[model samples]
Target: MHKTLSVATRLAAVAAVTLLGACAGMAPAPVFSQDSLPDTVKVPAGHRVVLETVGVGEITYECRAKAGDAMAFEWAFVGPRADLNGRDGKKLGTYFGPPATWASNDGSRITGTQVAVAPAKPGSIPLQLVRANPATGNGAMTGVSFVQRVATVGGVAPALPCDAAGAGRKEVVKYQADYIFWKPA
Candidate 1:
């Protein structure tokens, strides 16, 4: 009886260890990955490029526009954005947690042949929220389907503080994208 009890105890310990290993090896959360495809963006006008980053909470875009264009670099850590009716209310992340960036020429008015805006990097979320329709004189709005590829969020695409950056900002990994926006013809 004593030997049988000892064997049972050992088996239980082994089972517990196996269970723990399985839990620890669980797949990573749905947080966006660096290889994740980027959302599509359309160039809206003709002029020079202006970097535009839209972030919420601590998640911010690590971005740059055409090289040598000082005005081509801009990033924003936005708090929140709402519409006139205020119907869709979601978490700050749900709205802009995935750090996405875009660019427009100074004289751009939001209409033209769209071009590739930027390239994905190691620690970045490359995205382009192209407002398909430029404001029309008739006050009409036509939005394009959020494209995923030509523009993307390609960094440590954090889902939320609870995601890959919760331990601390220092512990979080950041990816930078190489953007390529040329003048529109």
Candidate 2:
């Protein structure tokens, strides 16, 4: 009985070590670059990129009267629904909402206030910077100080006319952007 217990303990220890080693072998998160980004969307000094994710999904828009002008109508910005993926193309989390939440699969999440935005290429959505609030839960989102949205593609308002005839109609436009999360250096 004593010999059997000793062998089992040794096997468990080996398994634990192997598991830890496997985790350590995971590829490190990719580095972020801002050389081509506009100054308005750049992460502020003293922060370093901690995680970089690609957000691939859609933005919803609604046909509504232009704010402050009842006579004018347009496709108004609504919200986003996206999956955040790592460089390896694995789903790491999600981004969505009117409040704009970024949630990690590890159960960590954050909501942030928009800091600034700059126009991207003609057909793409603007690049943006956000200041993250204190994260809820823990894990990947903990200690995030900022989030930058760059490399935007096709998130602009729908091309459909937004006249009174289409009032209350909703449309979803496909988009992709890179979200780089930063922490104080």
In candidate 2, what residue range of length 10 has the lowest lDDT sum?
1-10
Single out the weakest 10-residue window by summed lDDT for candidate 1: 78-87
lDDT tens digits by residue: candidate 2, 11-51: 99999999999999999654888988889889889999899
In candidate 2 the C-alpha lDDT for residue 1 amounts to 38
**Stretches of candidate 1 exceeding 4 Å from the true structure:** 1-40, 44-124, 129-154, 157-171
Instruction: Please provide the root mean square deviation of candidate 1 (C-alpha atoms, Å).
Output: 20.5
What TM-score, computed on C-alpha atoms, does each candidate reach?
Answer: 0.22, 0.83
Total backbone collisions for each predicted model: 19, 0
RMSD of each: 20.5, 5.9
Candidate 2 ranges with C-alpha deviation above 4 Å: 1-30
Model 2, residue 89: distance off in Å is 0.4
lDDT of each structure?
Answer: 0.33, 0.94
With candidate 2 superimposed using the best TM-score fit, by how many Å does residue 95's alpha carbon deviate from the native?
A: 0.3
